[model samples]
Target: MIALSDTVSASSDLLSTEIDGEVVMMDMEAGRYLYLDRIGSVIWSELKRPQTVADLCQSLADRYAAPIEQIECDVLDLLQQMRRNDLIRLHD
Candidate 1:
C-alpha cells in the first residue's frame, strides 16, 4: 500500500487534456485512455509535481465540502488504482 508520505506524479510519457472540468489521460506505453471526473481532474492536476498524500488530501479538503478522513481515504484509493494502471508513479 502507498503511504501518506509517499510522493507521486504523472508519468512523463503520457498525454493528458482537461475538458469541461474533467481530465482525459492516455498512456502512451500501454495505449490506454482513462477519463477522470472533476475530482479526479483536480488530483491529476496536482500530480503534475510529486506530492505527498497528506498534501493532496488537505488540498482537496480546502476546496471540497467532504470530510478530511474521507478525502484521504478516497485519494489513497484513487492513487493506488492509478498506480496499478501505470497512470501515476510513486516518487522518492
Candidate 2:
C-alpha cells in the first residue's frame, strides 16, 4: 500500500492539472479524461514515492507534528477515500 508522505511524478505520464488545483487525468491507454479535488491533491502528492504505510505515517506525523497513531489513522482514512474514488492503486 502507498503511504501519504512523499511526492512523485513520472517522466512518462501526461495529465494536466487545472488552475483550481483540480486534477484532470488523461488516460494514455484509453484516451480519456478525469477530475480530482484538493483533498485528492494532498493524497496524490504523497504518492510520488514508493513508500510503505509506516513510512507515510511517519512523514505525515512529522509534517503536522502529530502522534504517529493519529497520523496513521489519517493516512488510512485518506487512502480509503482515494481508493474509493479510484484515485490511486494499493499494492500488497
Candidate 3:
C-alpha cells in the first residue's frame, strides 16, 4: 500500500514521450506500452525523481484548485494502479 510519506519513482527501464500534452510510456522490461492523459502526464513527470505522496498531493493541489482530500484520493488511486502495472517503484 502507498502511504503519504512513501516516496515513489519511475521504474528505471521505462522510457516516456509526450505527444500533444499526453504521455506515452514504454516499459522495456515488461515489453509493454502505456498512455497517460494530461493529468496522468503531470503525475508521470513528477515521478521522474523520487517524491513523497504528500509532495505529489501538494503540487497537484497547487496546480488545480481542488480539495486536498479529493486530490489525495485520486493520486493514491493512480499510484496504486501504476504500481500494479510495474510503472513505478515505491520506497518505504
What residue pairs clash in candidate 1, if any at all? none
TM-scores for all predictions: 0.93, 0.57, 0.94
**The CA-based lDDT of model 1 is what?**
0.89
Candidate 2 C-alpha lDDT tens digits along 1-92 = 44444332222354656557766777576587666577556556666655666776676667676788877787777676655545555554
Candidate-wise lDDT, in order: 0.89, 0.60, 0.92
How many pairs of residues collide in each model? 0, 2, 0
Q: Single out the weakest 10-residue window by summed lDDT for candidate 3.
A: 8-17
C-alpha-based local distance difference test score of model 3: 0.92
Residues 34-62 of candidate 3: C-alpha lDDT, one tens digit per residue? 99999999999999999999999999999
| Model 3 Cα RMSD, 1 decimal | 1.0
Instruction: Pick the winner on TM-score between candidates 2 and 3.
Output: 3
**Tens digits of per-residue lDDT for model 1 on 1-92?**
98889988887777889999999988787788889999898899999988898998898999999999999999999999988888888877
> How high a TM-score does candidate 1 get?
0.93
Compared with the true structure, the alpha-carbon lDDT of candidate 2 equals 0.60
Ranking by TM-score: 3, 1, 2
